[model samples]
Target chain A: MTAFLRRRSLLQGLAGGAFVLVAPRALADLGSRLDAALAERFGERRPEQGGVELELSRLVENGNSVAVTVRASPDEPTPAALHLFMPRNPEPWGTSFQVAPPALAEFSTRIRLAGTQDVMAVAEWADGRLGATAVSVMVTLGACADDLYLEF
Target chain B: MRRALLLLWLLLALPGHAEPRAGQISGYHLLGEELQALQDDDFANPGMLWVDRGQRAWDAAAGASGTSCRDCHGGPERMQGLATQLPRWNSDQERLENLEGLIRNCRSARQQAEPPAYESDEMLALTTVIAHQSRGLPLAVAVDGPAADAFAAGRDAFARRRGQLDLSCADCHDRHAGARLRGETISAGMINGFPLYRLTWEGMGSRQRMIRWCNEAVRAEPLQPDTAKALALELFLAWRSRGLELESPAIRR
Candidate 1:
């Protein structure tokens, strides 16, 4: 399957078509998406000093679904909203969560990462100030996609 | 006859830990604090994503009937405590059937849709959702009557050493559960959290996949997923975790 893609890319090159046809959709531009997600979520709400705790494995065995735990210190007002994102995932807008005070501002879930990258978590504390933290993870192989369109 | 009976007892107990108990610890106890906390919380566990997907599929119409799983099983609340009794004895087929097998059978026989492939996304989602229905319910599969032979086979498989490593399930999970193997602690192997999400897989997988992974890890020929041998092994593990509550879609590292 790989060899076929390579040969097809060569033929496309000869046919004057650029490599864009063979490039993965996910491989296109994750940086802009990440920025967009950050901008949309934060919107000039600068993160306060240390309150959010991002728990994730330092070394991820795979990129398909890495377990992540984000918790805010139960000091005073607990976190109200928790937003999680991976800059390298197919989509940077992973998921937004609601954290109740009684729940102690904790959010946990599995998420996909496309490559080695920092997993970022931002929490909106009850004081309205935002607290954020991140952990870097190394992934071996990213998850395989069936929708990997190959230009014929 | 007395001497023969004594020898038989000795031989049966010699292979490995084979005693059936009323209950045991769920593998959740074996995980790290973070992983354990993840399992304890429903919102954060990654497996919930698959469960949501499964819920969606449950309501989506498919097959010739153009009906969703919700049409039959209704809601997960109605089907609680179902996964604990899986790998059931199918009297009609004269064989043991695991949860996945039953799901497929339903797809073919009832749904009239081509059953999804083993370990496929559709199958895993459905299995996870269904297994989640039994969450917190004690594992209680019957091993009498027609299921007795399969249970015995499972017990044998649990004891027999396999692979180039010359190890058995008992060697790591039973005898040396608290001990470290290559820096990782071995816990009593349990299956309550089957279709559980492994951090390594970053996705949900079945108990068959987990069994096959262990087999390959020890350089043993992994059995085909859902095969008779695999079903027997799964049945054994389920019985081993007899008293633990179902933790399907549990998180793992």
Candidate 2:
């Protein structure tokens, strides 16, 4: 009887441990995660729309790898850094990069989108002004969701 | 004279004697405009990441011998035009060996290390890096002598229809190459851009992985990777893709 009780307690303990490890990531809403990422990067700064251009195919056939380019208006001052966000992805923070001299305020990269959603890019200027733009992408296939291997 | 002409026409119409495709369509041209652009840009193409990884691994020492690939093969430039001639007859093993099989054998026998699995990151990187060197070369696998039997087997497999869909590779890739299926263009099933980064995969994959994926898509019995059947099919593909420029480590959707 004592051994059975001990085993039950151990099983409960393992389940609790597993929950603790997975809950934080699984439970957090994707939008909140994006907001959290933004807050972490730029505290107390609200970014204004425009002054930055985000270029990508509006209609995506496959959401695994999408080419994206974020460029600050050449007429405007070059931004200090660029931040990308994908709210529909598991992690909303796509990637961040610093913009330095000799290099323009434009950056191009390939990113994964979880589904159809608005992908945004924020550019932080030297004078603390934040400029942003978002593109609504219609993803035809969420290819990444399919597992690489499946049992016959 | 009439009998002789009929016999010649019949012989030409036979499956085994069917001439190779006179005009080949490259898989790259079949991609959507955006995907083509993505593949064009060095920075935007995700396959470059695997190439970068492979470049690093080229010089890194491994195994009991502590020898890098560079020690024997020299720089990756030495591998130029090599990918175009793969799935060749390996006399030492007394069997055909594809790029992945050759790499596996090299690592196991030469490096004295455990071989990387077919679709593993390490193997993909190595294959991508090596194949990237031969980019723009034409496919030219030998189809006679020791390779004849395998070529025949592969051609048979390509035409044989088995699966819930009852579709053969020729039914789609050969008969209707330019037609659209579910918003995606059906390519000629050319393999010049193998060891590529597929948007569907969200990562780099080998040609064997692509074959297995197609089999699953048609609800057919899965073809085990790196097997004799798989190697035969690869040799056949190489022959079919003859004259198509290599776009190894290409971006595909």
Candidate 3:
């Protein structure tokens, strides 16, 4: 009877330990997805926080598409390319724009939103280093209905 | 002879009596040859593959009853000019009927086929043919009476803000006309050119497609492509572009 009681206590301890171990890892996984996407695109060099701006609303009713604007730092030379990423989307990389030197310092466009997700924008400078920034948005209504074609 | 003289004198004295100028209409802007060329190149000339697809769909048999659009309307030519005046009051139904609504009605009443969704290519094609027939005619959407109420509803929809960004249609199109957004210059929010060939879309698309794209841009749940609200907005836009020449196949960046 003592052995069975000890076994039950051990099982309870294991379950408690498993919960503690797994919860943080799941969150880290989500963060790492964004980090990995940035790492792959921007490489080992970490981008500076200033000069690049990402404008988005705090609340989104639909998660299908969202408007985004990226502005390069005026102090630095105009960025040659701007890359956008949505961490939670099925495809994180939304689009990349190549800006001519004479062009304006800002680029704006629309992007697909997967859900309440973190969006990142990285600017690739002429010298090859990248700059990045991120924002979090809340989504209420999900886009892309399952039975879209069923209306017919 | 005295009565005839009196009638002539009265006709001459009528208020502002003068012969109406030939081609004189309110809000008419004549384009020079060069501008006309540019306008045509930009908007008028393009292949309408979707319209062709719609023509086929109209004739193709479908549904349990196996009927086609041809079974009722005869064919494409006979159905011309039908779309130009649509979204009109349907006395039979006692409601307004846009092109898509009419198509849906026809599908149920005659073709026995399931009606395509509001913004489906099938509906667009049928609408294209109908609008194409009135290519040169001035757009004449009734804005008074019950239709006026629809126009007011549409305007409200256009101005309402929702989504994450909380932007309205007026914010970009009305406020920022002639301004550059990204790489492209914004065009006036005109519906004269629809079923247009946008470089971005890379194919023929309707004004409703553009509206959906805008809704998506703002991170709003886009309404069904052919929603009544969208139709109402189209009616409002059509009224707004009343005097502009219809440029169905215009190109855009």
Candidates' lDDT values, in order?
0.75, 0.81, 0.64
TM-score of chain B of 3: 0.72
Q: Model 1, B1-253: lDDT tens per residue?
A: 5345334433443435446341244556655555677777788777998899888887888899887788998886676887999888999999889878988888888889999898888998888998998888999998889999999999899889999988898877666554555334455677888889876655688888878777766768887876787888888888888888888888765
TM values, all candidates: 0.63, 0.74, 0.49
- In model 3, which regions exceed 4 Å deviation? A1-152, B1-46, B64-67, B91-95
Candidate 3 residue-wise lDDT, B117-157, digit = tens? 76666777777765665666666678787677777888888
For residue B126, model 3's alpha carbon misses the true position, in angstroms, by 2.5
Clashing pairs in 2: none
lDDT (Cα, tens digit) per residue for candidate 2, span B1-253: 5345334433443444335563356667656678887788887688999999999888888888899999999998899988899989988777888888888888989999888877888999999999999998898999899989988988888888978989888877776555557667566788989888877767888888888887777778878877788888888888988988899888788
Task: Decide which is better by lDDT, 1 or 3.
Answer: 1
Ranking by TM-score: 2, 1, 3
Encode model 2's per-residue lDDT on A31-132: one tens digit a residue. 577678788888888789888889999988787777788899777888898889998888888888888999988887778888788898998988989988
Fnat values, candidates in order = 0.13, 0.24, 0.00
Which has the higher lDDT value, candidate number 2 or candidate number 3?
Answer: 2
Which segments of model 2 are wrong by more than 4 Å? Answer: A1-49, A74-106, A122-132, A142-152, B1-23
- Backbone clashes in model 1: 4
